[model samples]
Target: MFPAFAKYRQSFLIGLQSNLVYRMNFAVRGFFSLFHLAVVFILWGAVYSQNESIGGFSFGQTLTYFLVMLVMQFFVGAFNEDYQISEEIRSGLINQFILKPINYFSYRFSIFLAARLVTGALILIPLLVAVPLLKDYLTLPTEAWRFFLLAPAMMLSALIQFSIAYCFGMLTFWFLEIQGFVILSMAIESLLGGQMFPLDLLPAWIFNAAKFLPFYYQTYFPTAIITGRIEFAAAIQGFGIQLIWVLVLLAVNQLLWTRGLRRHTAVGG
Candidate 1:
């Protein structure tokens, strides 16, 4: 596996270099995201002025959760990847993967991983600079053990999201236009993946249902772990559930890849 990864390693490096050239463009994009943060703070601040806590979080803790979520999104958010992958599939660029020794999924994953690193690094610049200003609102995890669990949870979240996006991208094999499908999927993810708000803020039944879905594992689980909203036992259980989702998504992606390739070969060629 190590020897095989050497090939994808080159892809990783190339992706990193290519992304580096556009650092300023990406940096500016990250800079503008602060405006969205501003709007959130104002809206939530108003809401909190009326009440001490919403969904068991004090105003400060709730804001901290959103701040942490912003950072988590920088790390694991999968956007444009579906479009990119679908474009490649539609344009027959994947023919090279079949012809070459490289695995298409591995190649794309390495590159996307590099992209996430570059994006996360760029976004952190402004965030770290703003740290002092926002210190009053942000809260760090209380226990060192939470940090330990956080690392793997973050990785699982990344894999879970990427696998789902990849599976959506691969659907290009069967459909001519996947925009509607991809958009619908994104709407669901944003609603359910704790992108809009912590799932704990939802009604009991809905929150409980989300726990069984892969969406919550994407953003909510890790953020909840860091925010101390979840107990140690719950965090450990979430870790296991997240890990299982990763495995399940991987299996599903493999199945999609197998069938997608067959469809592509028969229809495209």
Candidate 2:
């Protein structure tokens, strides 16, 4: 167990180093992230200009939700593991992994985790600095416990997102050209994952329907908890739903990987 753990640690270090070498990319992404957040603030500010609240969200609460949503997105978003995996399969690079003792999932996931760690930190610096400037627009949870509860929910959210990406990546085994599928999936996720807006702000029927999907768990549910939109008991129940989604997605990922391995072939040297 120790040796295997060490192997993953090494994989993570390699990933971290590889990503750190491209510091400019992180800077560019951080810039764009801040720009996007500003756009959200302006858009929502306009919406709340006339009203004190909408859908039970005050102006500050809505902005706070977007703030947390942006940070959550930085932590879990922009992963291209699906595209990377598809490319590996298409280029026959996956054959190299078959020759190694490492678990492909663990190795790839370690790399994914490592990249997120570096990027998340890079994004965090500006986010912290922006907090004081944006304090009036931000509405934090009054209950300290809600902040504590957010940790696990965010963890589960990351896992769910990873599993979704991994499953999509595995589709390369069957569909050699999956760029369209990847784009479509990302668009759907962005819309449904509450990256565009808080899910609760949607029509009641739409919000209820979204609960049946995993995308909401990725961004909305966790942000809602941190912003106090989700109370203690509901947050607890939401966490249970998140855990269940993780398990379900993990099973789906495993099934896809096993079946994909059977169909996968190294076409190029």
Candidate 3:
């Protein structure tokens, strides 16, 4: 197990080091994410200027909500899905990966996590430094224990998202390409998963329907916990929901991977 982990460790370190080498491009990506923050602030500010509160969210709370959402997005954003996974599957590069004793899922996931950490830290450092200065007006969570609990929750959220995404990307084994599928999935996640706006702000029926779907567990509930929008009981319920969805999807991925491997017929292999 150690040897297998060592291989993945090496891959993750390589990805981390490579991200550092291209730090300028990463900085630019961070800047682009800030545009989303700006747009949300402007759009929501207009709406709030007319109304004191909408859907139980006060003006200040809504602003803080968007800020937390934006920051969470930057922290958790993964890279282009199809290019990373589909390319390997189509080009038979994945077969090379199979030859190694290392687990393919672990290798891919570790490298991706490493890269995300490197890039996310580049953006988060400034936010951390400036957050204290803005604490007077901004209402961030004051509970240190909640912040501590958030670390593992964040990791679990990222892992669950990546597993589901990579499983879909693995469909390139049969689909031949998955760019269109990737776009559709992202669109659904944004609209149905509360990535664009608070789920509570949506229509009651729509929000109820979204609760049954795995999308809510992606960004909404976790961010809610971080923002103190959810109390202890509610947070536990949310975590349970997330855990169940992760297990279900993980099972699906296992089934898909097994089927894919059986069907895979590359020339060399």
Candidate 4:
């Protein structure tokens, strides 16, 4: 069992090393991300200009929000694994993965984490270079504990999202196709997950309701914690919400994996 995880870690490390060997690939990704940042800046800049304040967020505050959002985006936005399960199922690769002497979840998770490390580093360097100019607008949290607590909170979000996404991917066992559904989920999360705008800009009813949803904790709550936008009490409550969602997704993914594994009759099996 221990060696199984070790193998997964080895695979992940190999992935990082492989990516490093292909420096141009990382360069291309980083270049595209910079263009994306420019687009976000322009769009948000226009929105801020339209309104004196968008739901209590000033221009600088909103810009800072996007900046932090960009960082979180960099940390987690490498691959879309939603289609990976479907492809594996279609091609019968999943059967091999299951038969291997390893926990499939751990293997998949380690690969995800490893990819994030490489991509995050690639994204951070360029962004950090820009930080000196944007420092006036951005507010790093003053509370030492908040910074410490933020790491695990973000990790929880990453794991929860990966697990839920796997569950969605596992739906491939039942459905022949799931790309449309994946796109829909991505769209809804982007809109409501505080990626485009702060949740505070959303209606009061919607903002309150988001607490129960996983999307809020993904980008909004964690970014708020790091940016010092959330008060200490609210940060605690946000963490609670994030943990609840993590638990719920864990159970859901476990159930999905069990059921899907049983139903899985691979093409080449």
Candidate 5:
């Protein structure tokens, strides 16, 4: 067990180094994210001009929400592994994993985790620097305890999102052309994951329904926890929901991978 753990650690380090070598690409992404945040800032500013608050959030709070949401999205929205897995399946490159002693899921997850660490750091540098400049418009959680709790919530968010993406990638075993599914999954996630806007802005019924879905836990719940939108009791409940979803998704991933592997044949070179 120790040797296997060390091997996985080595893979993670290799992935970190590999991604760092392409730091310029992530730097470009980070730049584009700033532009995206600016556009969101302007748009939200326009919306708040005529109103004091919407969905119990003031303009400053809304701005703060988006800023934090942007960073959370970076960490939780690392889904590229799905596409990579799909492409490898199509190219019959997955055979390499079958011949190795490594657990394919763990191997891929290690790489994904490392890539997120590198890209997350690049993405966060600008946000961290901008925090002081945006201090006046920022609305942080009043209860400092929620801040401490947010780390675990966000980690769960990453794992849940990664599991969802892994399941989508597993579809490649059955359908070699699963790009459409990948795009569809991303579209759904963007819409329902609170990436586009806060779930609080939605109608009560819709918001209530969304809470039951995994998407809500991906972004909105964690943001709400840190922003003090959710009370302590409610935040605990939200964390419970997040944990349950992660377990459910883990089961789904395992089942799908097992079934998919049976159907998968590395036919192409």
Candidate 6:
């Protein structure tokens, strides 16, 4: 089994080396995150000044959500995967993967893991340094299970995010351009994934509807679970739904990959 995955291991090493070359970029983004966090605190702070709470999140809990979200985005973000895969498809670079025994998705996923690992580490430093300053406003989980369950939730979120992103990138095998799809997806995800605001804070109908989509499990559910924003029953239900979404998205990804490869090969890709 170890020998079978040697190639992916090599890919991971290469990805780490490549990402290291771009270390300054991650460092700069991490540095700027402090400023962004400051702005968010002030903005949310003002909002809570007028109200005791917004959607059951005290001002501190709200801050904690955004802070946790920023960190989560670093670790699970897959924005570049789509563009990279699309470029490979358009430039005929995907032929290399198809001609080889290696799987394109597996190779890309290895690199994705490396990229997130590096990016997350870099961004995490600044956040950690700033964390002490805001420790007062940050809320820890009251329930012991939440502390235990957070890791698995985050891991599931990573798969859900990557599967969806991989499918988006596979669209390039059919469409010459997928910018519209990516942009539209990003907008919907931002709103639905609790980037713009907590999904629970949305109108009841919208909140209920968004939960049916994969985006809900992405950022909000995992962060909410750790923050105690949800109850134990809800958390358990979310894990089940999260697992289902993973299976569903993986199936979709497999379907897209199979069909997309046939189309590409048919056209001499």
Best by lDDT: 6
Candidate 6 lDDT over 1-269, as tens digits, reads 77759999999999889988988988888898788888988898889999999987799888988898889888887757888889888888888887888888889889889999999888878987988999998887677899888889988999888998899999998899998999999998888899887778888998878777889998888888887778898889888889999999988998998988888852566
Model 3 sits at a Cα RMSD from the real structure of: 2.4
lDDT of 1 by residue, 96-212 (tens): 788888988888889889989999998898797667777888777679888888888988898888898899998998998889998898889888988787789899999988998
**Per-residue alpha-carbon lDDT of candidate 3 for residues 79-176, written as tens digits (9 for 90 to 100):** 66446887888888888867766677777788778877777787876566445644554676687756876776677677777776788778987898
lDDT of 4 by residue, 94-194 (tens): 78878877667776677677767877787777786667766776656478877887888788878766876787788898899898888888888887778
lDDT of 5 by residue, 67-143 (tens): 88888877767647888878877788888888889888888888888988888888877877677778889878678
Ranking by lDDT: 6, 1, 5, 2, 4, 3
Candidate 4 — what's its lDDT?
Answer: 0.76
- Per-candidate Cα lDDT values, in order, are 0.86, 0.84, 0.75, 0.76, 0.84, 0.87
Indicate the TM-score of model 4: 0.88
lDDT-better candidate, 1 vs 2: 1
Give the clashing residue pairs of candidate 6, or none. Answer: none
Where does model 2 exceed 4 Å of error?
Answer: none
Off by over 4 Å in 1: 266-269
TM-scores across all candidates? 0.94, 0.94, 0.90, 0.88, 0.94, 0.93
Give the runs in model 3 whose Cα sits over 4 Å from its true position: 125-137, 143-145
Off by over 4 Å in 4: 1-5, 17-26, 47-53
Which scores better on TM-score, 1 or 3? 1
